[model samples]
Target chain A: MSVDVHLAFPPLARIGDPLERVSTPALILDLDAFDANVGAMAAMAKKAGVALRPHAKAHKSSAISQRQLEAGAVGICCQKLTEVYPFVRAGIRNVHISNEFVGADKVAMAIELARHITLSICVDHVQQVRDIGAAADAAGVTIAVLPEVDIGQGRCGVASEEQLAALADAIAAHPGLRFGGLQAYHGGIQHVAEWDQRRVAAARSADKAAAYVRFLEARGLPCPVVTGGGTGTVEFDAASGVFTELQPGSYIFLDGHYGSSEWLGGFRPRHGLFIASTVMSTAKPGMAVCDVGLKGVAVDSGLPRVHGAAAADLRYTAANDEHGILHLVDAQQPDRLGERLLLIPGHCDPTCNLHDQFVCVRDGVVEALWAIDARGLSQ
Target chain B: MSVDVHLAFPPLARIGDPLERVSTPALILDLDAFDANVGAMAAMAKKAGVALRPHAKAHKSSAISQRQLEAGAVGICCQKLTEVYPFVRAGIRNVHISNEFVGADKVAMAIELARHITLSICVDHVQQVRDIGAAADAAGVTIAVLPEVDIGQGRCGVASEEQLAALADAIAAHPGLRFGGLQAYHGGIQHVAEWDQRRVAAARSADKAAAYVRFLEARGLPCPVVTGGGTGTVEFDAASGVFTELQPGSYIFLDGHYGSSEWLGGFRPRHGLFIASTVMSTAKPGMAVCDVGLKGVAVDSGLPRVHGAAAADLRYTAANDEHGILHLVDAQQPDRLGERLLLIPGHCDPTCNLHDQFVCVRDGVVEALWAIDARGLSQ
Candidate 1:
């Protein structure tokens, strides 16, 4: 079913002076690393002969998506329909919403957006497909609908081949819905501590998804695409010959959690993202205060790690609303009051969501700033 | 000292349609209840015979601060100087930055801002005070400087009266800086879980702060303002006769953590904030999927608690970037797909920071939506 689009008017402007104007606790993007990260991901996908569908949820900026497309990405994957609008509003042609939408209002919004963009959305249930079909019918549009299959995360998607086939048949039966393929993403393996375990999990996940595709082929149902794979397991999935497109997002902005993972295989791409913060206070001997805290970086993946400060053996500990506590691990103190400290956030995605702009710097000079245009416009 | 005025541009136009919008991971504010909360706090301060300096770190909205000022708040206390900009830009004249700012850029920015508003900022170090004085001099502004004393939180601020007095003396010695008052905020007591212990901790904190105030009085230093207290200990500090003004931010948007805590003395203030999320999948028996996950609500105070849906014994357990896992504890089979659930975030401040708009509803109907205009404007 064609997805309806909601227009957030004034179309988000590219943040001009994101770093200079955004106050403390705002998200800052390093332009140099961000460009390199995007280029490297595209190059990796191209080398593997796989399609690159960069996930918009990582940065949620239409400008960034445009840049990705210019760099030869096939399409962009959106987490939500509401998140798809800014991209479509920016005239993005191909979009895939990698989640399910059930409500009439939400489906209607998606279908509306589909009018201007090549839209596809994932559905795990037949009821959701019927709803999407009805919405697409009302909107006078035919939409590509993919039945998501659960590999391991067990969040959405059909649990088995039988359920997946049934959902695909239901979508095929619907008038306005066209069977797109399958969304097979293993979210649980993203942070697997060991590389071998992560590869095994990815292979197992791909095997499950491949079984569904084989079933669809036997039934003669058109399954044109198979999309999935995040940054953590994208390479593994690409090499497994199961995924048609790779959606590795955080490769563009390597977070502390990703950079310091125990997975010692091929996951350590590079240090691609860093938050520039200032030492606000130094009242205690063993602790220093920073401007970034819970408001700056998400700690769900764990606390941010200190970066580029050679003198201090400091670790980011407790965080209040505005201030971050840096616990001194070694005797060397942190930069005194007024010194700028670069921080590697625990999680890149949510940390990117916290900032309105990213201050891109390279080789000790500010290059550019990217506005996380869709920073908090979650539906 | 004249402050540099930073005028905020008019708010972005209402981006999306309100009525047809599906409610999921949406911030909902009850305007009527919010006004009542402001009035209730004002009345509480009046009864205690202390001025109310409502903290802006919670709402971070000038619209809310205007109501606080109209009700009875003498001023607004911002956690940081950057937080002061939005309010100052909105023309909320009196602002006290409770957090310490010790950078060349930040101090200069503070002094620049002091040029247009009645600005006061906290200082934790003698060197910080000196820097502030120098910045004020450069900006040609005489700024009110408050010495911050650590009562218990051990984050930022002077640990003892001697340090506090010395910082005050340092500020007083500078021509551009005026020793305005003392800032003694104990952040640890704000979420103490239990009632009696929280009260005791708060009382101890107040006692320690009062002793410092008395010491300052003995030293012949005029302490014009003794501001400190949060939603958890506003009453204790007000009754302790130490603080001339109470600064409570989260009271306006009462969160689940505060509601779960017994420390606030068993009174349900009926505050405005809530997060509305939608059920995405119910594939697993006794477990439901929601759109509001780690990205929707801040989980630091603990996971968001289910509210308004009695049928589902729902509790947010695990959250991903785009999904929330609701573990149903009581219902035999809870939460059908597409169900709307109202959630009380574990922490309201950071949760609010995650949204771009507050879908204000009254009587079960979405009435007005306001942009969290400065949601991620934090630099």
Candidate 2:
């Protein structure tokens, strides 16, 4: 069902120009706020005792990761092997793959990465340990392995102490694998509404992690690292006396969904990333049209919210493949045509995925542009 | 936060010989099914005597659009000017920007596009019309304009005939602008749960569209084209005798959400596109870990469902950035590691947004690999 037909366009546009001048449905990133955000997160992590292992999955860009490292992150955490390749190629030295890998192709890729950097990954089963051993054997290198323990979120990792120990034992038995640490993460706790509730939830999960660490120690295995924590529950994780490292992404470009939550204890969400859009239509009384559609900002967490514009009460109501519908939150005048507006996406990560270059803007002027290096790397 | 770190391979696998060679989290278009789907939609349009103006927002690939034009479509509807640019550059002829253009840059882009192709765009406001006219004047090209009418989806577009007429009159009065037609689209009706309800809803919206067409005709405006209809309501739209052209996308990749909907009474969802993913981990008793995740598939319409290999009732339960938690729908067993599975994404468009290439396969053999040429063109 090919529908390839070209529609012409106006030429190249300069930054800070009205909506008409900029390209339609562009992913715009504010450089000033972004730099400030990086500085702020790094400062916060510096004050905290735990290491800041910045999650690269949020913004899979080597440029962003390099900035994070420069700011003071211990390393970067890549979500997949394919995602890590570009970063490693770009000279990111320390990386933790926060997910499991399966095939020989992926394993080979991971080993290849480890040869250049301090690479580590998580595991939740014995078979994974065996596969790691096999890959490491082929690569002639011992790979560090952390058994992922499911404290909550119900996604992956070992569920019980017995299972965790068994998996760890399997890693110990494998000549090419090392029992590096434990991944005690509660992904669901990050989205909890209340701050205290989130803290308590994190603490409870930490209890399981502590017990698992103890079990491993009793078996004459040293659990040097017990890592886990997201942007949602990092504070609790830092003070929980359980986690050795904290992984939090999205603190840089805090999204509307996460900003709306009261989980982070009064931390004001500094809107760093924004989808710069122009009001395409305002013929309707209470509705306005924008170029940012489903292809612009992600709608998984919800549609992006309009920011610092005349239509302050404007809410993104509906989205098609390429156009977003902004409706008045309160019955006010429709948006003016060609008005430039900044939108805070519902979810930053997926929204970022819809773009290539982060149009970094500073003080209403165009600044540096960062390429999303690891974007769309599915393999 | 980047707590999910996985760098090990699972030992067990259940996929057969050939499929295992395929890449991870790949978007596969079944050529046989895709051809049938295109032919079926074309046949439906031919039978209904309505011109087809398939929306390219769903596929955004020029290759696919060429196929639609070859299938007897009158033209194609693009969602954004940037999206239209690639197709135009590729020499796509007739195009209708089903959405409005706002800024000078975008309007200029739109005007430049008009110079090469018969270009039409939608406007819901007079100011947008003026801006487009200005851009067209600069480009030295005449641009066709359509006033988008809000049929049911409370997005952009005018609500009543009076509003439509005012916008239409404004476009007529503007230099370098022509009153092309009315963009009467019912976006909400596409997901109706019941067949009778969907048909009735389509009829009601069609009536509104017919009224607008009659209103324009009475006012001596050329209303030759009235475009808007999706895969869900194409049948009713073709029979309504109101819309001169149908702009239906998503007919190629019949997703789980569309398949689950009762919007189209007797429409059988041909599984043309499938997210071919591998089972990464199966350590849990009732769950299997998959390579597909929030980064692989769109969950807006709902979670992806298992298409074939029904040994386990697989439902995507949770997702991180790169890993999906597949819950066993049936208690049969967890999927063996590295097993290849076809997942029907919740929404085809967004899921397609996550990948870079469409690996076209015919009868379990590799056919063609089409780069999503226009993917990630957010701006």
Best by DockQ: 2
Question: Which stretches of candidate 1 lie above 4 Å from their native place?
Answer: A1-28, A262-268, A330-335, B1-22, B263-268, B330-335
lDDT of 1 by residue, B1-379 (tens): 1111231112212334452253466788877778777888899899999999988778777777888999988889877655666676666778888887755456656766777777888888888877778777777787888888888788888887778878977887888888888888998888887877888998999888888888888999878888999998887888888898899988888898888777444334675787877888876667888888878999998888787654357778888888988878865763478877877888988998887777766666676666565565443
Model 2, B246-281: lDDT tens per residue? Answer: 998898778777787764343455878888888887
TM-scores of the candidates are 0.92, 0.90
Kindly report the interface RMSD of candidate 2, rounded to 1 decimal: 7.6
lDDT of each: 0.77, 0.77
User: Comparing only chain A of model 2 with the true chain A, what is the TM-score?
Assistant: 0.91
Docking verdict class for candidate 2: acceptable
- lDDT score, residue B10, model 1? 23
Q: TM-score of chain A for each candidate? A: 0.90, 0.91
Candidate 2 regions with alpha-carbon error over 4 angstroms? A1-24, A263-269, A309-312, A329-335, B1-17, B262-269, B329-335
Top TM-score model = 1
Each candidate's DockQ score against the native complex?
A: 0.32, 0.44
Model 1 is docked with a DockQ of 0.32
